[model samples]
Target: MSIQCPSCNSQRIITRDIARKLGGTTGAIAGGASGMAGAAGGARVGTLVGTIGGPLGMTLGGLAGAIIGGLVGSAAGGAAGAKLGEEIDNKVLDNFQCANCGHCFRQQD
Candidate 1:
């Protein structure tokens, strides 16, 4: 769909997803912080399992577990955050700008 400026009728428009960007970043950080606990648990389990294969296996297993846990948390958080941000953009923020006239407006439903 083409978005035109309500004030100027200009078709040149830009999107400013301020909330989305901020939300995603904040959520990722929060999720990663929380993921630390998950990582610790994963590491413990990995270490226990790895012990059967000796020292190298234990080290690799722990590292892999921690990394996976952190990544999963970060990804989940980012997705959730982005969705929330999108809602804010649509309903609360003036998310569109007319490039030709520099007028900011909310998307019209």
Candidate 2:
């Protein structure tokens, strides 16, 4: 769909996406925090498996597990947040800017 500025009636428009960016960051932080549980579980499993090799292997395994768990959680959370933010941007926020006049407006249905 084409976007036009209400004030200038200019066809040059851009999306601000302010909420999407914020939501992704916030969601990532929250997801990482929640992932601590996953990390702990991963560590336990990794340590058990690494036991065959000894202390050094166990240490490495635990570290790897924690990192992987946290990363996975953050990724998942970020995606969810971005989706929600996009919806908000489209439906509730004035997410578009007119490149010609610097006007911000929401798209009308």
Candidate 3:
């Protein structure tokens, strides 16, 4: 499937393939960022839980929670970021115009 930019008509469209690639790259970055954030959050939670639950609880629960939270956060962030990135790429493709013919071209894979 292809996306057409209404402002530019059919002149500028973003191909699904290119958009996917852009999304992949964007998702990777976002995933890493999210993972880091999740890990930090998990650590904080672990600390809190440790204090409340004592040493044994902290050792088991904190470790498990951190791993699980980090993985889940990374996946969600990656997917969300990929979608947003694809949209932005589409917008950029839509606005670009050819200097010679004033024709906008859709991004190609």
List the pairs of residues colliding in candidate 2: none
Q: For model 1, how big is the CA root-mean-square deviation?
A: 1.0
Find the 10 residues in a row with the least total lDDT in model 1.
Answer: 29-38
Q: Write the per-residue lDDT of candidate 2 for residues 79-107, one digit (tens) a residue.
A: 88888888899999999999998999998
Whole-model Cα lDDT of every candidate shown, in order: 0.88, 0.88, 0.64
* RMSD of candidates 1 onward, in order: 1.0, 1.3, 7.2
**Tens digits of lDDT, candidate 1, 31-109:** 8877777899888888888898899889988987888888888888888888899889989999999999899999878
Arrange candidates by lDDT, descending: 1, 2, 3
Better candidate number, 1 or 2, judged by TM-score: 1
Query: C-alpha displacement of 11 in model 1, angstroms?
Result: 0.5
Candidate 3 lDDT by residue in tens digits, 1-109? 5544444455343244455566766776677677777877886787677877788877766777677667777677667767776677566654345443466554555
lDDT at 94, model 2: 97
Judge candidate 2 at residue 25 and give its lDDT: 89
The positional error of residue 67 in candidate 2, measured at the CA in angstroms, is 0.6
